[model samples]
Structures are given as C-alpha cells and as structure tokens.
Target: MLDATIASLSELGYSRTSTTEIVRRAGVSRGAQVHHYPTKAELVAAAITHLFHEQANDVANRLETMSDEELDTLDGIDLLWGALGGPTYRAALALAAASITDEELKPVVTKLLREFDETLVTNFGKYFNFNGEFESFWPIGLRFAFSTLSSAALYRELGLEDRAEEIVTVLKAMTSMTIKQMGKNSRQFGIQS
Candidate 1:
C-alpha cells in the first residue's frame, strides 16, 4: 500500500499527492491508512525510507554475489544510471526537489538521502579506501551519479539522442576511472580487512 503511494509520487510529485489519492490507489480505507500512518508526512517518510532501503538492498545483493570477472566488466555507472534514470528513481528525485524548499517534507527527504549514502558506504565503500568517508567518496561517487542521471534524463526529455549519448559516454568514462582508481587505493590500504 505504501509502495503504491511512493510509486505514485513520481507521477504526482510531492505537493500534488494527498492521503485521499493514496488511499484511493492503494484500495484501502482511510481507517487502514490512519492505522499505519497518522499523518501525510509520516506516510511519505515511510515510502521514501522503503525505496531507499530497497535500492540499497538490491545494490548490496548485486555487489555481494558478483565475481571478479563480473566486476571487471560490469559498469557501476550503469547500475546507478539504471536506477536513477528509471521511473522509480525519478520518484525519489521528484520528492527531493519538492522537499528542498518545503520545510514540512525536509526531514523525510534528508533522511532518505542519508540512508542512501549509508547504504553506499556500507556496501561499496567496504571495497574502497577514503580519507573523510562520504566527504571524499560521495563527491566522486553519489554526487556524480545524481549529476550524470540529471543530464541523461534531461537530454532524453529534450529529445537530443546524439547529445545524450556523448554525455553518457563521458560520464561513464569518468565513473569507470573513479572505480578503478578506488579499487587500486582500496587494495593498497587493505580496506577489505
């Protein structure tokens, strides 16, 4: 039910969504929703938390099961791109954009990003070495992920196929290089242990 609400947020955006719509889509009574979440903010917070946790789990599982040959050939940027450029990814973005200016929704979105970063550190950073943790890795990593997707999605939104491809190419190269350098640094520092 909450998942239904979160999924709707991508299409409806934050300011537009209401408990009435969520209950309508979820096919549940107001009493059911109220039983779970007394306020709209609480519902949105849980939905954001759910998506962040789900994506983190998905990435962690992928990282864990993958072998060396897979990681060697795998494009980490694609993993990020696939997530951010997709419908579900944009939902988080839409929520974030709305949350920034609206104090009412700030905590939910802020915590969602924190959890996302925490997941990244717990999963990907386990294989890397960094000086100030998120200060170093997130700038070259998650921030890059967000910027790259914003460009790609914007190009596609504008119907510029050629420009989008070139932008993606450059971003992918930078991402690959960062991953490679981090791997080397991780090994040098024995971060795995």
Candidate 2:
C-alpha cells in the first residue's frame, strides 16, 4: 500500500492521489487501507516515513561497499543524489508542498523531515571523515548540499533536465571547493571544530 501510495504521488501529485487510487494500485480492499490509514494525511505521512527509511538504508548499504578513497565529498553527494533525486523524492516533494497549508499534515511532515535530516547526518558521519574539530560544521554543510540537490530535483521535475544536471554538477564542484576552503581556514575563521 505504501509503495502504491508513493507511485500514486509520483505520477498524480499529492492533491490527486486518493485512497481509492492507492487501493486500486495495490490491488487491496478499501477496508485494508482504511484500517491502516484513516486519513490522507496519515497515509501520506506513513508513506513518506517509509520512503525516508528506505533511502537512508540504501545509502548506508552503498557506503558499506565503498572504500575510503571512493567516499569523498563529491562521491557522497552523488550517492545522495542517486538515492534522493528520483521518483520517491519527487513524491515526498509533493507531500512537502501540500503540507505547507495543510494544518493536520504540517506537523507530521515537519517531524518526519527533521528525522530524515538527522538520519542523513548520522549516515554521512559514519562514512565521511569530518575532522573532530569541524564536527559542528558538518550538518550545516550537509544541509546546504541537500537543499541544492533538492532544488535540482525540482528543476528536473519542471522539465529542465539539462539545467538540473548543470545545477548538480556545479553544486558538486562548489561543495568540494567550499569544504576544502573551510578545512584550510577553519582556524583563521575561528570556526573551532
């Protein structure tokens, strides 16, 4: 059902994805969907949560197979883009936009997004070597990368696929340079770990 909901959201957008559509796609009875998710908000929240966890796990599994030399910042960004710049993330984006004015869904989406942020941070921390002194800056840098990648994904959805590719390539270069500069000037900037 969750998979069906994700497909529905990706293909139909959040506003157009109905319980009936999800039920039909899942080949499940309306009663089962109703029993699991009583409202659209609840159903979407569950689907987004499930998707987030799956993406995180996918990244982690990929990281496990990579050697340290293959786990540079650019590689990390690529991994993130691979995991998030796709249909599932598009579905989540629809839910995120809908949550803006949806009072009932706002809190749920907010909470799930925050948790997802933390999960990404944790996952990156496990593989990337953010020096102990610059640990506090890790999340800030990661959030910037995530925002840029997310915007690129949106641009792709808007039919600007080439521009999206350019944005991602530029983002990778910019992020790599910024991290190198930060490492070099951390002490000069008084940015203590």
Q: Write down the TM-score of every candidate.
A: 0.76, 0.89
After superposition of all CA atoms, the RMSD between model 2 and the true structure is: 4.1
Clashing pairs in 2: 133-193
Per-residue alpha-carbon lDDT of model 1 for 112-153, expressed as tens digits?
Answer: 787687676667665433444334655456566656666787
lDDT of each: 0.69, 0.82
RMSD of candidates 1 onward, in order? 4.7, 4.1
* Ten-residue region with minimum lDDT total, candidate 2: 184-193
TM-score of 2: 0.89
Which stretches in model 1 have alpha-carbon errors above 4 Å?
127-142, 154-162, 175-193
